[model samples]
Target: MMKVLLPVDGSEPSKNAILKGIEEGLLEGKEIHIITVVPGIVPVEGYILSPHVDDTNQQLAEETLTDAKALLADYPNVVAVTRKGDPGTEILHYASEIGADLIIMGHRGLGTFSKIFLGSVSSRVLNHSECSVYIVKS
Candidate 1:
């Protein structure tokens, strides 16, 4: 069976990507893995913030995965996972671990300036993934 990795971040584009995949029948009879990554917390001035922040991030990640799974409820071969780290790095790692054949993700279509300032996760995965990547633009 084909293994498809879907990385979502609770964005409209990500939701659209899932919908498009279903509409195109790309996920049928495939092993679908849906993942959401929460960035690792960083300390400020050598001091860490309250633990509530971390809890909140983790909760959000779980919620995102839950939402994605809900979208794919009709698909039986679907797995939802959550990770903590850089979104692009975690996505690549998960895909490699699962030996995914294809990755379907969303493109936020950030402006050049914003793209430069805030690195694009989709671009990173596309450029570095060992498997084919299908981008659903917003």
Candidate 2:
């Protein structure tokens, strides 16, 4: 079975990527892995602000994965995962670990800068992924 890696961030583009993949018949008969990476919170002045921050981030990551999974309800071979780290790095690591045949993701995500041609995470993945990448634009 073909292994496809899909990284989402609960962004509209990311959701659209899933929808587009389904519409294009790209996810049929494939082992689809849906992942969401929560960026690690950095400490300031050698102290973390609040303990609940990590928990909140983790919850959000899981929610993101759940939402993505909902889009692929008909797909039997689907797995959802959550990771905490740099988004691009974690995505690449997961893809390599799974020996993915393809990576389908959005061209842009929920980032501060919307004017850029492509989101930083997507750009990094596009430039470095070992497998074929399909970028969906919203």
Candidate 3:
């Protein structure tokens, strides 16, 4: 009855994490917590807003969660959710809130500059998360 957090960003690396877990027998029959964090709206008073981007972000988040949930359809104890904010922060917050014992995520995400210079969201979560983190390399 242990809890495991799976943060997916619709990336191959993220998908591999799930596959790795299953192959390693770590997530085969356990309850899983899946989350996809959409970048939150950053309003600029002087700039014009595109309604399309706002709606699209939320829609994308929902779709990502749906797809991720489907990946684990055989598991009955799965909880898929979506949040808005910094991906790393939200992932860790959700893990802490739910008291997840382990977190499985991708080594890198859609980030272009971050994963090159310092680290990606996965690295940030590893540094900040209170629980054990397993980062699946792409």
Candidate 4:
């Protein structure tokens, strides 16, 4: 069973990647791992974040994974997880730890216009990951 890693963020581009992968039959009978990473934003030294902030993020992450899974309902061997850290690094780590054979993700993430010149998470993973990477353009 080959392991596949897909990093999602609730963005339309990310959702497009997921749908595109399915259309390409890339996830058939594979052990698919769908993951979403939430930024570990800590309040400044003098500031404090409301408890609901973290709670809301977690809830949203869960919902995103659940919806993604539902989209691939025909596929049985699938798992969803949430992580906290730098998205690119965390995705690479998760793929390595799980022995992923391929990394399928969106070409664009939730970044600003600066991403057009700088590298996006997909670019970073493509450059850094040891495993094969497939970029789905939105």
Q: Which lDDT values do the candidates have, in the order given?
A: 0.87, 0.92, 0.85, 0.86
TM-score preference between candidates 1 and 4, better one: 4
Candidate 4 yields a Cα-based lDDT of: 0.86
Better of 2 and 3 by TM-score: 2
Tens-digit lDDT string for candidate 3 (1-138): 889999988777788888888778888667899999999889999998898997998888888788888888878899988888999899989999999999988777777764463347888999999989987775
Q: Which pairs of residues collide in model 1?
A: none
Candidate 1 on 46-81: residue-level lDDT in tens?
A: 776999999998988888889999999999999889
Instruction: Point out the higher-scoring one by lDDT: 1 or 4.
Output: 1
Model 4: residues with Cα > 4 Å off, grouped in runs: 114-119
RMSD (Å) of each candidate, 1 decimal:
2.8, 1.2, 1.9, 1.9
| RMSD in angstroms between candidate 4 and the native structure over all alpha carbons | 1.9
| Structural RMSD, model 1 | 2.8
Which has the greatest lDDT? 2
